[model samples]
Target: MFKIIDLNTLGLGQEFPENIYFVLRGWMDSNNIIIKGDPNVIIDTSYCKSEKETESIFSFCGMKPDDLDMIVNTHNHADHTGGNNKLQLLSGAKIAMHEYDAHYVNLWDESGLNLDFSDWELPKFSVDNILTDGDILSFPPFDFKVIHSPGHSGGNIVLYDSKYEPLLSGETILNGDFGSVHCFREGNRALFDLRDSIKRLAQLPIRLILPAHGGPITNPQKCIDDCLRRINILIKEPIKMGYHFIRRWFIHAVLIRGEMEREKLFSHVSEIENFYAINKRYIKINNKDLFNEIVDDFIERGVLVDRDNRLSVINP
Candidate 1:
């Protein structure tokens, strides 16, 4: 079971055992944690929806935004890096992200309907450090190596904290479902990269898997294997309708298609002519399940809405 932690203005340190606090977003329950170390470190920041809301996460960590010494981003998605500028200004902490994903973090292009960038301007921050696979951070009371898991994004980094045998995985592994791999549609190579990255981590002696979204897992290898199987299946099936259809469907049917009763949406889905072609193609290969699964995952994240039987995207 999951629990929610509320915060005061300055912060409620020691509320979480060992000074570890989960900063969760109420929308979808997507959470990031603050590890109070020699100098406290934040795993990731919530979407840059607004400063007032985002900064509250710091208080939950038992510290203010300015108290953080380091801010680590697992990838470049806006949700993970949105509050970066605000946090930096308050905490004066150095921001770190995988070198490969730094460009997206630095410059967010709006051509794509990626909602992570909606309602907020890209914050500026210096990459005080870079993390690569096998690189270990030995900050007192916590020591972990960086595992480069590139399927979700080219530069995705999962911090393996040995002290607790836990991983601070940004978007790599989330409660048995995988992170959004379609974000890197420009290169199919990233899909394969993600497979390899998961396989590599499966070999490690990991215990708990912590993610920026969803719940955590006590069994790392099993979760990795499940994600691997899903990726493998997607590869063999081939997205027959092409990437454009898949992207549009995600944005429309899943995001903008206002909420209704779940049963109503499912029953009447066949009537939506705009998605007929893609749906038919997926149905042929039994890939329709995958499409629905992704939609359900987003719904769980509060990124997708299902009201009554209608569906739509939640306005950030």
Candidate 2:
């Protein structure tokens, strides 16, 4: 059984990047990046269940939602793009996203945006400017070169600040792992694409990589190398890839909710098998069964512990 690792344990706190007002998020939220500048750009506002919460998040960073001038999305994921509409409406900020990924956001297509997996609804947000690779965003504080790193999702990007921090790799490369792929969305193409993206980013002279989750990566090259290794493993062992997806989902779910009734979690998991585990020719697995099997394995390996028919991470 592959050991299930908790994101919190992988190191979430203790990171303070100078170029950003990093809002480390909990509850399946992407780590939000706020660049307080003349233009005041906010990348990946994360999943705020309410506007008040969103406003509070900005307030904590000593700003209001209306202070933002631009909303730059790293990808089309709900966690990354969820707060675009609310923030834009409040601040009148023009939203910018990769032209390739903007199509789904512009259309507000939940399925295409992969919002179908989210329990919370993301309000429709439109893009005002379409970004391409090599686009330079010059704000008063700093300039960021948009690097289109499409692998985790179509149009996923890494904002590279050459003069300062290297990259804001949104869901592209976390500490010891990368983002999960939805076979239902891109089939096996996602894995192949992810491998290529990691290869390209690995060549950069990077010392810091601020990911959308977990924390900032100090040894970026090693992390990038690890990401490539994981991608290769997934491509070679497809069923193990399915295990990876379900394992992360359950860990995140339990992390957010503390614990859940085993049967209830399994039933809910069964409801969304096709979202991450179905691609007739490429990926085919009943996530419900896989999820159950993963749980037993986790318990056996002490990654998780079962109590009163409820499941939770051992020390999370």
Candidate 3:
């Protein structure tokens, strides 16, 4: 387990040339990376709520708003790009993302299904540069090679710096498994492409995986191998995979409120068209009955409990 350290105690405002600092806090456990070099670089700006915190972090690293040279976004997700406009305005740094994802970054309303973006407002911004696969970004002592890893999102990319031994992976490759493939959009939840992307990443010489969420993964190979093994099993037993997927998100939504009405839970999960899309593609099921079945399945498996028409996670 990664130790959760208080950012204030780290004295991040101190200067350390040629070092990477992680600002991991706020909503979604958002991680904003600061790379100290000749042309200082920041990766993923986290959510809107983290704007002030991110600014403080930059100051802690002895960097002012205008000190940023470039802001690289891993994808178009709101949480990752929410602070883009603010940071750009404050630092006047050039914003860069994949061409496919650039549109969403500038729009502020393009996200996957079932995600509650009501609390945040994405400000429109222009892309200063467009990044593509195999692109090499030079930051003095470190050179990061961009790898386009789609599945979680159409334009997701992972940055690899072998010499530094850190893979700046967004949400594409999590520590133990691939990020969510069941998105709101139809083609966005492409499981096959996600599997291929994971396989491609496994071949890389990655020592550390700095993900957008959770803790940084030190045992890169083991995480990749475990993810692959899990995917293989999921491929063979898609229904079980689907069950776990639904259950995972279902519990997450409910846990947010401690408990929720059964109808409300079903309504929320059913909103993601990709959920049924994936199910229909794999299970060959038709109709809304499967949604109920999945909910009942979760209850039966003891992953959840239902009482008085309300659903909640089974507390351990």
Candidate 4:
């Protein structure tokens, strides 16, 4: 089930004024920030399942559907932009996102990203504006500087405000851990880009971080630093990172079903479109080649045994 956290209970204090309302929804606690001002703006709508909840939130803030002027999507992920069509239709708001992600948002299934958007009921929507790095989006009371931060997903962006010091960090950086970049796409899991994006964000004098998931982060610098440290470790120990990724899903699959046929496991993965669980890490396989390689590595490590076309967890 999902829940909502108003501005007052978020513990942001006076730093975040009454104008900003963070709507937390879904199992992952995806956040949709509603800024109350002239030409009200909404950052990242949650999944379609949370549409009603999102509407109620707007009403609670004394806002009608037509009150919203703009809808900005941080990325093309289904969870982030699932409610775009609904909100846009209701509010007649102009939807804006990076040009690179614009097509993906419209033709998600055909993007070959290996993601399952069936459950989310993602609707096709056209991008009203194409945003680029260094573009300043001026919507009364706030001026957001778009910072192109890829790696988690191609075309991912972070909105920064110099004076306000609140970074609308999409999935680039979270409170404790960073967003997952191991998905199947050309530039989705570019490790070098992820490192560069994090480094770039670390240089900013950010006071608060309003991420897509989790609560608002007051210690922005430390969070970025911690993420950088982890990324550095992954860069140095590539094999270890691969093993870590494989083990997480391997254990999850075995624990849930006790034993799984090799073909059945592969079929299940195709259906879900990723290895990670809902609301958990976002690591995913981009293709069958990588999937087989990971499985072979697990077998060689004696963590999993493949016998009679079935894969099972090795007893300790």
Candidate 5:
């Protein structure tokens, strides 16, 4: 009977009880769920920052270090599986995850380089068993089916409880917005496929969603619509303008101001990248051309006025 500790913001850290414990805010904290069963089960060990944090979590739950049964990962992202090694060691639990992310888990060094690797150092860890879609993990009295909803990542899987009719889809169907599909290195098809996957989930009777980011939504239909809207923008708006057009739009949207100087606009560009979580390196490699094209389109559309190196938004 543990109570939830609110982190104030809806961005990070929070806990909910019901055999399910969402470590971060918005059901996103290194998700750690406890399944009610013969021996009890725990799902998705969180990005354990330190042994002390892990111990504190267990202590708050009135659980001992050696009490965890089964630890599973929704995918191979560091935030989702950062504490695999520590949790397993403390609880003597078996680590489970999609086979596709096995390499990421096993090779994860404490460099914060998994999903949040570029910005944060991810602790190294590994998985013991490979899981797949449609596979049911039984804890007796309750069982969850793995829904292969790959889009955020190749190995992404959402756990569904037939009894509760709820989904523990880490980062698959976030509330307030959809999950970010910015893994350009993984290929654009992955992002496009995500659109299809969410549409399929929209048909389900899921009442509650446990997403990796943003708040959990009781209204599955609304959540699905929100996801569709965000994704459809990628398909409809981005495509209409082409990759280049979108890039320029981002630049003008972020960097340009009426009659702003080049240096000021350039600084704004950096701010835009941060706003969209766009990496400078990635923009140079994959999106530079597309970004420039988008800028040109913005110019043609009268959305922006680019003079020499100076730029500013035009009245829409």
Candidate 6:
């Protein structure tokens, strides 16, 4: 069962203008922000992972899954939107995401939806309503204006509350870390978009940031500044960024799939297309070389407990 806690207790000391609840999720899934009101809205379903977990999703936020009026996805990433299909089926809730991102979901494009990247059993889910920039969605006591923040992915969005000064930042801006920027197709357009999106949010009157990945961010401005500095580093040093990206994402892959064959990473990342682009355009190294580089980086980071040939986040 998912435990729902008050936002204040979850580290946000100040009370918001509405009844907002937070759910802490495992590393395999994203955290959730629930708005309990006339029409209950769950910001993200976290990651349903498998169909078996869907059976008990109704227990979230003290309401049955079917009672949920809306399932708002912060982005199209697998961790963020994997549960869309099952949740919608239970609640018949109107699923909403940025208009730009809706293309992947509506068309069931595995690559665009990031479904190809994850080994999870992510079912294709349709978007009931397309959320465009400036769209205002009200869930009773509070209303949010949609901000199309397309740096993390082409369709990632930030929900802004002008009156309350809080915004749902998704994976774009986190406590100390931002989303992983890979050298995918379009070259470095995603990188540029991330910079622009952060700059745009910096201009907003934001007091708090509710992100999809990390826990809630109270000091959004400082976080945005840190994101800009990190972006500069990423842009200036794609080689190092590439190495780090592989390391972090590999940690994720190992965490979810569990102790994958070390060599399998080459084939797995090949499916993402960006791996080739990273090597050809920026890193200028073969997959094996890059893999070795990332392994060294991971060891230095101490997140790698198992120094064996296989990659694992836990000690075996």
Candidate 5 lDDT over residue span 14-108, tens digit each: 32234444454212235456554445556665544544565566655567757877777777765566567777777778888887766555665
lDDT of 4: 0.71
**Per-prediction TM-score:** 0.70, 0.83, 0.73, 0.74, 0.67, 0.88
TM-score of model number 6: 0.88
lDDT of 2 by residue, 1-316 (tens): 1111222343435333443566666646777777776788888877655345656766666678898999888988776777887888888999999998899878878777776764445788788999999999986456788988877788888888666555789988999788887654676588888888888887776757878887667788788888888888988988667666656666655655558899887776566644244422234655555666778888998878999999888742
Q: Residue 30 CA error for candidate 2 (Å)?
A: 0.5
If candidate 6 were superposed on the true structure by all CA atoms, what would the RMSD be? 2.9
Candidate 1, residue 160: CA error in Å? 0.5
* Maximum-TM-score candidate: 6
Q: How many clashes (backbone N, Cα, C below 3 Å) per candidate?
A: 17, 0, 3, 1, 26, 0
Can you write out model 4's per-residue Cα lDDT over 1-316, one digit (the tens) per residue?
4444554554655555668777655432258888888879889987666677777778767788779999999987767877888989998999999978876665655453224522234667778889999999886567889999987777889999887778999888887666665534444346678889989988898878888987778888789888888877766766445544445534544544557787777666545534433213333345455557757877888877899878877741
The residue-level lDDT of candidate 5 at 55 comes to 50
| lDDT for each candidate structure | 0.62, 0.73, 0.69, 0.71, 0.59, 0.73
Q: Order the candidates by TM-score, highest first — what do you get?
A: 6, 2, 4, 3, 1, 5
Descending-lDDT candidate ranking: 2, 6, 4, 3, 1, 5
Q: Candidate 4: list runs displaced more than 4 Å.
A: 1-14, 106-109, 112-120, 239-267, 270-273, 276-316
lDDT of 4 at 68: 90
* TM-score: model 5 vs. ground truth: 0.67
lDDT at 165 for candidate 1? 64
Question: Over 4 Å off in model 2, which ranges?
Answer: 1-19, 117-120, 252-260, 274-276, 279-288, 297-307, 311-316
Query: Which segments of candidate 3 are over 4 A away from where they belong?
Result: 1-18, 26-29, 106-121, 183-189, 241-316
Better of 1 and 5 by lDDT: 1
